[model samples]
Target: MSEIIRRDPRREWIARNRLHPDHASVLAALGVNRGGAAVSEWLGPHGVVRKNPHAIGFIGPNDVKRIDRSGFQQGGQSAATTPVAQDSRRTVTIDQPAFLVAVVPDLTGGRLSAHDKDLLGLARRVADADADQPGAVVAILFGEHKGEGDGELKEQALGDAGIDRVVHLNDEFYAGFAPEARLAALSAVEREMMPRFWLLPDSPLGGADLGRRLALRLGERAATGVWQVEADNEASLGWRCTARGGAGSLDIQRPLPRVALALAECAEPVDETRHAAEQLTLAASIPTTLSRIEDLGQVAVDPAGVALAEAEFILSGGNGVKEWGAFHHAAKVLGATEGASRVAVDDGFMARDRQVGATGTWVTARVYMAVGISGAIQHLQGIQRCDKVVAINLDPGCDIIKRADLAVIGDSTQILAALVTMVEQQRGGQRDAA
Candidate 1:
């Protein structure tokens, strides 16, 4: 004979109602404790519903435990227990400073570059060393702030980067590659403000040239290729610095100089403090100097011809790519430097120089686009410094999709062709309008 299963409506109701007095007993009788799993909610001994937070969420594939506050795991949970997030940075305003730690950032493309932010962080360290009489971090900016359209937002970015004061030189004379005029402006700054520590990012984008020229003009020995700085009582400037010398093969330790050109990632970018980036004006007019070098403006260069390490935009392909010509054409249309995975290089589809990974050259491109690439650990490490990553692949589960800011799951050839057509149409429209 078949087992006769009779359902008690009242007992079923009690089992479903977690807040009921006999809910636990009813669930036990039905041989089900919240559907055979101890998750989020259960009836307590005294009829109170108890929540087990640990059992609510599972660990992700990345080995990190994630708590789903959306109630999908537990069914209709409230977020009332969640704590409010608050800003951790302290707001500081330095009205009267003992001295100024001047920073001349590269400010490539009218905005503060990563190298520039790192230099500011170093300057903040120097300025804040003496707690009793703190020195202000003064940034001398050349040309106009062009990246952010809103003026206040641009100034706020500088303030957030720990700049106490800003000296903006937007004169046409200071624009482009007028080293003589720029040197004269620095000379004027030297005579007037007389900053204690002059810091600059030792980058190819104008900072290195200006910093060396400033040191020479001021007749002070500048520490070039500085990567580390620490406080020392015995030092003349109350600090010591370790700099790379002999073409980055030797480490030279010496007393910190008044002028120092620091390498990228020398110090972490400032994020814990908001400063008053007050605008400063020169007391006296900057003296006019004869420019021996004339500004001819920038010459056109092929995107593919650019070195991988210096290229601002990169389009990389991998073994999954079938149409190499389409990939190259997309890169050309998008004005991106061509890069390739190690497998592609091994397969003779790409050059050894075009390979991107830990074994290959490390790139700091503003935008990195990977097509048909299942990202390896080495390749991901190489593009770690990239600002944005775009990935196109047939497999949605590929490792490249995880790291990409934007991922498109489609055929690489089709996507590249579509992108090329869109860019060409846009260019044609622009030309017609012009």
Candidate 2:
């Protein structure tokens, strides 16, 4: 017998509209008429198809209707589904703030560093502690920023990081290692804004130096290695913080001061809310001071010789790696520090200092690439703070593949050779262009 199916365009559209009032009912109705009352789909209502899997079928042995686990019918292939995109961040605007929480972030390489983002998150916490009299998070950016797109896009980046206001110091005087000029500019900001709390990332060769000098110049006893901060009634600033002392051997809990230096991962980066990062300007011009220090440009340093804990990019090899020379060449071409799994270290393929695991030195690299390394528990623990992990392995089901943001399933030797060739070609092209 030939069966003719009647398609209702209105019902099909309703089935596709998840937010419609009668969407569930329409969807159920459309899904109940397919073969064995299982997989049902509505095709091209408005150039869009929607599928709904149904549990309606012949009763099983247990006298219960058999549920179709697959999106397709018993003998039919399932259509591909496109994931719906959703933006969940709430937009926040602080027109009139009771106070301001000033954050001076070390925009290393003209972008917000991980440590800088963490410090901003901490600042957001401090600013939003008292909702009734909520303060605003004001970020003070120095120098010209790059790689963050145009001016509007750059402000959007700051907005996404929970910055309510931005004070950019992009003058030539503030450029380079001009602590004296920067200190003078910060002093002007303090006088003009009078921010409630001043926060900075306690990172070496970045915010640490400037923060200490700012604290000294202002004569405000600053909290140096602050990791945790909480609102407290007894505290002068209405907050208390836990800081590390004695070379990170002692934990000291005290009242939060006006000026504080925070460690990396002091708090999670702001993700739930977006703010209006409105531009702000200082009323008075900063007077340039005679600098004793000469501004010599950046010195070239080899990435492979950098300490594992401080390395930003790492290329790690494991037991599956067959060609050590190719691995080293890949690391060199990629400009990444060298790291190795416990097995590779034990086999004497990599030095003991290059070992990466819980037993080895903990690494906080921005990008950790593992070639032929099946991720071990200890190795995963060591790179827990890394921003991204790239895995190259023969087995797609390897533990490292599960942790990797990008996984390439192939032979390690071939992958390394290919990567080196690609990098060398790009460099050669760049040289020719120059």
Candidate 3:
């Protein structure tokens, strides 16, 4: 019988490595057929591969031992037997030029707003693109300081959101949404840091007014409802925003020194991770020329409630709702904040603060129960961010019925009454079980 000869797969691999030691692993990993083309040509589409193979070689004694024991047959082959060189190393540095600053206003109840955190994340991305050094994400917090503990807590929260620095302007003048006072404080900061870009949330509070006023004061371009911001080139920055009338988006590129007002719910909030941030307390000198406006206390109403923008669950009323007392009662029973359509607010059926529509407050609620609402386009826009919309109206052909997740066709008062009873019964049952 003739002697049978078999080839070892490991030995074949070792032979290929000896022939093309640098590119053998890369060709195998990328599944590229190695013919006459050089390894540089093969890795063109992928990032540049340095000629020094030792830079990409395995490290440590354990790694070297593992590679040596992998059946890599090394005979008298000098090419494969040569050890990887360790001296030839390259260091790369990225150069960033400008700072991305996020201006966070104090929300009601002294708590940080969700939109503020989202703006911080967006600012971080912009800073990373434009800044070459560490401590690029800067936060400018304007609010009244309750105490040392509160100030420390707010600073810590900003640090947790990846803020590189916190400039807290805690003054009695910044207690309310006074435009002139805010403008003065912001102008001081602008003069000191001279940031490359400024980001402010497009809210009814100080955000919208302060952004525009500050931009005008600083003689920089201002863009509102800016959803996206990025570096256009090494010398310019680009801001993406929706055009008026909902036509399309517009990309506006400008050189350094610009301010952008971010729309509500535009960017998603990132996970909270603690980071070290330098905190600075600024001494704001309110300009003597800046006139102070007297703040009249808020007028008391029949059913005092949370702001429409901050409400979690809203029970909205429209022209179809006849009994205002019954509507308020139902909302109270269900633990829902009261909201009003334009017609209801105009007709004096509901408070102006409770209005929900394009001209009114935009509500982002977990559950929006529309009682007799017609679901006009303006109303739809206000509640567009609602997780679930439940509409109660008599007309089946109304827009609310078509767009609602759950539509009930009946008398608004009767449906609201029934819902209130059901919720109370569920609560009662839970209480009894507990």
The full ranking of all candidates by TM-score, starting with the best, is 1, 2, 3
Can you write out model 1's per-residue Cα lDDT over 1-434, one digit (the tens) per residue? 76874557677667667699987777778664444454345445455656767655556657766677764453332322333467789999999999999999888878898889999999999999889999999999999875455878777899999999999999998888988998898889989999999999998758799999999988889999999999999999899999999998999999999999999999999999999999999999998978889999988789878999989999999988998988888888898999999999999999999999899979989899999899999999999999889999999998889999999999889989998999999999999999
- Per-residue lDDT tens digits for candidate 2, residues 1-434, read 65885778788777667689997777567663333343355576665554554423334566655554453433233332323456789999999999999999999878898889999999999899878988999889999876368978888899999899999999987888888888898899999999998999999878899999999988899999999998899988789999999999999999998899999999999999999999998889787789999899778689977999999999999999998998888888899999999999999999999999899979989899999899999999998988789999999988988899999999989988988898899999999999
Which candidate leads the pack in lDDT? Answer: 1
Which ten contiguous residues of candidate 2 have the minimum total lDDT? 74-83
TM-score of every prediction relative to native: 0.74, 0.71, 0.47
RMSD of each: 11.2, 8.5, 17.1
Error of 1 at 395 (Å): 3.9
For model 2, what is the error of residue 170's alpha carbon versus the real structure, in angstroms, after optimal superposition? Answer: 4.7
TM-score between model 3 and native: 0.47
Ranked by TM-score, the better of candidates 1 and 3 is 1
Residue 387, model 1: lDDT of 82
> Each model's number of backbone clashes?
0, 0, 2
Residue-by-residue lDDT tens digits, candidate 3, 112-222: 566776777777666655344533666677764332266577566556666676777667766665777777777777777777678888777558777888889988777
